[model samples]
Target chain A: MSEKGLLIVLSGPSGVGKGTVRQKMVESKLFEFQYSVSMTTRKPRPGEVDGEDYYFTTKDKFKEAIANGKMLEHAQYVDNFYGTPLTPVKKMLAEGHDVLLEIEVNGAMKVREKMPDGVFIFLTPPDLMELKDRITKRGTDAAAVIEKRMAQAKVEIMMMENYDYAVVNDKVENAVNRIKDIVSSEHVRVPRVIDNYRKMIKEN
Target chain B: MSEKGLLIVLSGPSGVGKGTVRQKMVESKLFEFQYSVSMTTRKPRPGEVDGEDYYFTTKDKFKEAIANGKMLEHAQYVDNFYGTPLTPVKKMLAEGHDVLLEIEVNGAMKVREKMPDGVFIFLTPPDLMELKDRITKRGTDAAAVIEKRMAQAKVEIMMMENYDYAVVNDKVENAVNRIKDIVSSEHVRVPRVIDNYRKMIKEN
Candidate 1:
């Protein structure tokens, strides 16, 4: 059987170390993982590459893509349209390269609707206090914003049941290894391997 | 949430190197895994421990256990009764130790009927030719018996579709590592971890 690449959605609440885990996974080179670059109307920050970080686009272009069904899943956050572009992800999967989409819970849920077979992984902090500490230490957001994010985090944690796997990001290295294991094991899933076996049996 | 250990069933046709892989897994000391010892009416061979190899039992006792619904699955092979004792498996699982059962396809299917939640894995040879070579090299069975076994292997390979995972035993080390990964990843399954996340969310 011709193996198809997996569409893996890595999502978690804010400050759950999803980014750190994903960064380590990429650095490890354990698997041929291609990030599904998201299209966003938000302007790029300093040191952010246009295509590498995100496909920064005009609001009108993003809306046009949405209207044409080019966006797999899109959401508006702080008046900015951010969504996964369908074309690249589809191309990557068709070429047998596993695609990783690191998005928010809402976007992940939306992706689930379009691609139900995708592996949805939710990365969680060891504890809520740990999550709070991580966010607080970042110092990027105001106290009120962090509080709002924490509230949102609780709601997102409740959505963990919707994922295929829930990995606790207790340590970045361990979390990355777990994700690697998950991906490796998923390749041998019965449905995916049955056709190959059938062909082999026929040949034999 | 309190974690319950997994019931993992490993099965394969003859000459698939299941024993070697299991040995490697045990030697790694990665997780607490206990074997679900089977009871057999056949006398133990040289250097075989009664409990460790198989729980040697009288034919009468084996029949009594089968009648009492104690055998999870049983079969008559070479005029001897071989079966898995259900009580010990349950006890190990209750004690939070992952249980491994290495049995034939029929026994694995029977176990599936009894414990539908168990993770069933089918180990396979790289190809039928490799399987034939391995079986031939063993120098135990006659040519006629080997032919019969090859036919049985075909049937068993077809049954691989019913398993949760199909791992090719091309290399013992790789197969062991893949099974290790599967066990590690299965723990983080969404349904298994959702309760823990719910409790944490509520507590916070």
Candidate 2:
């Protein structure tokens, strides 16, 4: 009964494995979902495209877009700005394509304010201790940065209230499977499909 | 994240394959769910037990239960009264056992009125033409009865708005799998599991 595509937002605290889980979901190709192009002030981490992967832009330009309300949801992580472009995501959804947005928790909350109908999923680490281990194991952040991230993770984990689903990032494979099920299940959710059936009955 | 049992109500128009689909779901042994014992005024058709399969009762006693608001939902079908006893279902849910109830459309709606939290599923045939064929092929109803059932089917299908999910009974296996996904997906629904996470995070 669902013809229009769904807006699925995946977000979580830093070091919760949201990035790895989202990467696997896209690579699995089990679902027909399009990726949203986001604007970022951070330099590309090798092989990332300018428009396809992210819109690599200056901090001023990113701020301009934010001020103009051109960004759907934006946040600063590790002193670099990242935000999703508003128009493209809407255009994709309007064209009957499901859009998947992998964003930070604050940005996801902003997206929820603008698109309350979107499916918000929170990816959490198995435990706070495990979360701290993952962050420290990354080896790129300094000890102070790691400590800051641990504090932020606790606050964001508490923000699970803003999500529609809480998937534990215990294993990448398991988390993606649960995500796929949620997407498939949402397609058959009564509110999403009942109108088509209502119309079909009248015509039949 | 889900702890309390989910109340799953499966209903559809006559000949829409709700019973067959529900049977497969239960037999699949994929989900941990219990079945509710229904009260039926119809005589047992061999091998059916009074308390196990259905609570065999007279029309007067069934009416008395209905008048007492003991039945969660009840309806008269083909001169037989069929209903679900409320207290038992509630007790099962309280004990953290998911309960699946398969009933006719009218009874399903009545259940919705009382327990809006229940997951309501509407089983549908591939099409109205197919629905008519299924009813006719049963070969038990008279011509007038078939006609009445077909008319009732349209009304029931129109009542699809009252459900949370609609699965097409084109193939029993496919429908059951979709049902399994929905059940798994419901376990992660934010409202159902958010409080649990909130408590976990607070303790951690």
Candidate 3:
């Protein structure tokens, strides 16, 4: 049987270390996963390459793609549209490359609706105090904005049960290892193997 | 939070190298799980240690234990009653020691029903031919008995999907590692942490 790609959607609160965990996963190179380059109307930061960090786009172009159904899922955040494109993901999957998307809770839900077979993993902070500390330590947002984000975080934390797996970001190594274990363990699930066996038996 | 003991139920078809897997797990000493000694009515083989290999008991005493609810779960096999006792398991759990019980499918089911929180792991032979080769290589069972076991294995194989986790026994090291990862990963499940947090918050 041919190897099939996995569509993994990771969602979490503001500072639960989702990006760090994803970075570790990419460095490990244990699986064939391609990170989805999101299409966003927001301008790229310094040193961030176009089509690598994101597909930097205009508001009209983003809206046009959304209208044409070229985007798998899109959302407006801070006056900018961010979305995952379908064609690239499909092409990667067709070439047997697992795809990973680091998105927010709302975008993850939309992706789940679009691709029912996709896997979802939600990262959570070890504790509320630690979560508050992490958010404050970032020092990018104002106090009011941080409070608003924390309030939103509580709502996001409640949605942990909705994801197929939840990893608490207590430590970077442990969390990354957990994600790696999940990817490996999921590959050997019985249904997938049985399906492969059936196809093999048919070929025989 | 204090470390809690795990009740692990391990079941697999014959020739799946479950015994080897358990031996390696014990060797690793990663988790504090001990092999549970089952009470059996069968006469002990020469050089077998009572209370080490099994708790050799008379048929009447075995039946008495079942009637008195001392036996955790029991089944008749070839006119011998083999069962797990509840007292020692309870004591072990109370003292924070994880216990692993290697039993047949029916026994595993019974334990799962009794202890709804128990972890059930199903080990599988990589394929039918490999299973047959391993069984024959054992050279203990008669041809008729071997055929009977293979037939019985088919029934057990069908029930694998009921298990919480499934590991294929292609390589002993891989199987043991899978079980180890599963045990470690399960302990970090977010709901359990959330429950502990909720309890502390309530107490405060």
Give lDDT tens digits, candidate 3, residues B1-204. 665678888888877877888888889776578778999999999999999999999999998999998988999988899999999998887677888998889999998888877778889887767787889999998999888888877777777766777787888888888887777666655544556544433442
Candidate 3 docks at the CAPRI level of acceptable
| Model with the higher TM-score, candidate 1 or 2 | 1
lDDT of 2 at A31: 84
Off by over 4 Å in 1: A140-144
Clashing pairs in 1: none
lDDT of 2 by residue, B41-129 (tens): 99998999888999999999999998898999887878999889999999999888999999888888888999988989898887888
* Top candidate when judged by lDDT against the true structure: 1
DockQ of 3: 0.30
Ten-residue segment with the worst summed lDDT in candidate 1 chain A? Answer: A14-23
Error of 3 at A34 (Å): 2.1
Task: Give the C-alpha lDDT of model 1.
Answer: 0.91
- Which 10-residue span in candidate 2 chain B carries the lowest summed lDDT? B195-204
